[model samples]
Target: MNDVSYSLKVFKQIGLLKPVAPHRLLGAGLQLAKWGPGLPSGVNAAAKRFPKQTAIIDDAGEITWSELAGQVNQLTQALKERGVEPGDSIAVLSRNHRYMIVAIVAVMQAGGRVLMLNTMASRSQLGELARREDASLVIVDQEFLEVAQDVDRSLVVLGWADDDAPDDLPSVASLMAGQPTSAHAKPSRHGQIIIFTSGTTGLPKGARREEPKDLKPLIAFFGAIPYRGNSTVVIAAPLFHSWGLINFAFGLSTAPTYVLRRKFSPQQVLQDVERYRAEVLVVVPLMMQRMIDLDPAVVEKADVSSLRITASSGSALAGDLANRYMDLFTDSVYNFYGATETGWVTIASPTDLREAPGTAGRPPFRTTVKILDPDGREVPQGETGVIHVGNDMPFGGYTDGNTKSFAEGLMHSGDVGYFDEDGRLFVSGRDDDMIVSGGENVFPRELEDALIDHPDITDVVVTGVPDQTFGQVLAAYVVVRDGASLSEDDVKQYAKTHVARFAVPGRLMFLDELPRNPTGKVMKRELPDFE
Candidate 1:
């Protein structure tokens, strides 16, 4: 679509085309002018427009927009008063809660760079990353106080504390208590947000990104998914990941009521959706699988008919899993394909999922995708090659100074994929994941997809293992459905009929479950050795 038409569509979807009171518009414009359209500005505007409206629902309970804005402003002042300066890096180690949101926004408003730390990181890893990032302060929840203290005991600040929590470290509530709720002075420079990549393969790398100067990223996202303004959204994904972070920024503009939990529970997700009548549910693919895998009685008790859009990302969504989820719930699944470095490359809508299962839908506005061979030439249609993407909100490279491979103006996504005749993109697997066995090349995704199609198979992972004859042969680790039985011979027969002879696993193992990281990607390194 052209720029003019695309802008119109985005404006309509975000409710910008609707009539608004002149005072609210003026107030919002003033806040944007002062804060330069970051989270602080967004919160201030929402407070002006809908002070009584619910802003967030967490473990503590619901908080109104006005209350949230007040807390953010107070925290900003407190941080500034406590010696936080412009461009100072502040590490945040906490789960998804109101205080985590408040601490991040307050640091940004205070002109301190926000570094989001993974909650699953070990104490040593957290300390090493904090020292490497040169963080001036560390804000953490009570649960993670020891980790934060390991990073720097002198610079620790509590983000969330229980009623009986220790009074040693200054908490967000204590700092904001009796403090002025009025807006603080605007800083000379805006703060950058640093997000670490999922360290499934190696050590996590920090990807730095600043707030966009224009609305192109948001426009491109809304143009693809049907997210409306003033709706309720439940974010089940971890906020430290790029997928959840993007949704948080989207909420800033569209003003969605956010529902958050410290830990992910499928039953709790259903209950929250039904309680809030949330129109949007954000999660990783594993969370969706778990929700659908719940007991029939438990699933039937919740009324989730109100969910209109179930946004999924952070990993590949299997075709069979998508089909099962849509069959159980509304046909509202939207799978996103992208990485920390490339932003969003493609978005698969409900119709796209129905027609071309496992296919990443077409690129939205202002984003370009290309399939390029090793020689940096465009590959033919239906030819597998490295996926490259260009977008307005690309990351500013990794903090370690290494950059992704680039061709022309696009950055490599490190994944191999192809475009079908209908123009839909189907990701085959990681470019580095392909293995040659018995003089034939094979990708694990092809085998995994086939095995997951079986009625008794719940989950599966295929990897290349060492072999004396073939150099390397395929090994399959599978999880069977409860009350079902499948032997190695049964799986071998099924694979023999469904897949190529070379692609069949040389060895098979059955387990209760496949080990996965927090973002739902299979931990290939964690797979057990087959004797």
Candidate 2:
């Protein structure tokens, strides 16, 4: 056998193929090595194990494992030909598509950093991010090409039947030609990926992921859960987000058939699950509620039989909403109490979902979580405190002088919450977002949850508004259900019954809709002033 083939065989025989205990490894003993970021190696392994199996399926087309590897190699060569080299940051501003995945892998293979820009982000915002990172190249689709037209960097326009291509833009496929696939790709650790915070509080800050020790815990946590390996996963969230990238990495390493949906629509999600026979789905709570809000006929029509696991992150999952989805799929929904800086610090599993619907599950293997007071002392169980996690947690401070954000070693989640007797973490609202009225501490999430209980309330954001007498009073910006009209008095009355009186919004503004960022997170900073 050739040298590469012989090495791979030796690696597999030693039990590197599967994540198992050292003693459990099979053939050759190579001292159980961890697989770091090596796209070529990953592609090689996937090709060796499942050459005929589908690697990625998107609107553009389906690619088998073999094809996927070849394309990545070709793309890597193409990128190198264009002067893109190791350690260069390449910003990708495009929607979810097969090419996006191929591009990401290829960038990694070429030892280039992948800075994923939200396609939903405004052109100016995209340009600012690219400029801030000093990105070497920008890959954009037709829809967003206009946004990057002014970006002072080389561009690879992903054609999407637009009116006309720019003078210098080249067809994406044509870029790859006679690339050397045999060249050894740099390790995953050699490349870094920066995920910027979704700035609801202020301007976004970049969080650079360096060191394999910095990301393995996160990537490993996803691999350990959801019924072990050899499971199919569905990507409903945008690839740019932490949740999306985690699932994507897990899918790549586990060799799971990853099914991608270009954009999330309730109907589209149902159709994709049925079409791909997906065993797993990564969905946010809002998306779940949207599906639940649909007619029962729609739920009955979508065949979700292949689903084995439903994972929820990026936001809290309401008990009723969690129960509703669990009933629909007969699969428990898992939630992780995590942030962009730290990944899966604590996660609630299927059983946890059924029993403790609101609690984000227990800490994953080899992860330590501490609920601490402001002074950093560990708080007793059931006492609300900030969630502090460590796995060499990656909030090495924001690039924009936000070092105060990370206290000691833990990335101060800024969220307040408590652990139950079972050690499950329940997240409260952000420390800043908490509402204080008449000296009573009130979490807006609790108020928002109670408000959602009302049939007419479609969406609501509770904030502490300026109050002359009370310093700051509870206020709410509510989006009423379509065709239903309600006054602040009605909402106040409804909330009084469900939540504490002080927690009720003393001031309320009825809005057509709440301002949301690209990921559906309510932009509380944009809320107008209300008495």
**RMSD to the hidden true structure, all candidates:** 1.5, 5.6
* Per-residue alpha-carbon lDDT of candidate 1 for residues 1-531, written as tens digits (9 for 90 to 100): 679888988888887665678898788778878877568888888888778889999999999999999999999888888899989999988889999999999999888889888887778878888989999998888898766657657788888898877767788889888889988888877877899988876677999876877778878888888898889999999998888988987677787799999999999999999999999999999999899889989998889999999999999886478878999988999999998888998999999999988888889888889999999899999998999999888678888898888998899999999999988999989998899998998888888888988889989998888899998888999999999999999999999998999989998999999878778988776788998
TM-scores vs. true structure, each candidate:
0.97, 0.88
Worst 10 residues of 2 by lDDT: 24-33
- After superposition, which runs of candidate 1 have C-alpha atoms over 4 Å from their true positions? none
**In angstroms, how far off is 64's CA in candidate 2?**
0.7
Q: What is the Å distance of residue 310 in model 2 from its true position?
A: 1.2
What is candidate 2's lDDT per residue for 19-71, written digit by digit as tens?
64444232112111333544445555665556677887777668887777777
Cα error of candidate 2 at position 10, Å:
22
Model 1 scores a C-alpha lDDT of: 0.88
With a 3 Å backbone cut-off (N, CA, C), the pairs that clash in candidate 2 are: 13-27, 37-188, 347-361, 348-361
Candidate 2 TM-score, true structure as reference: 0.88
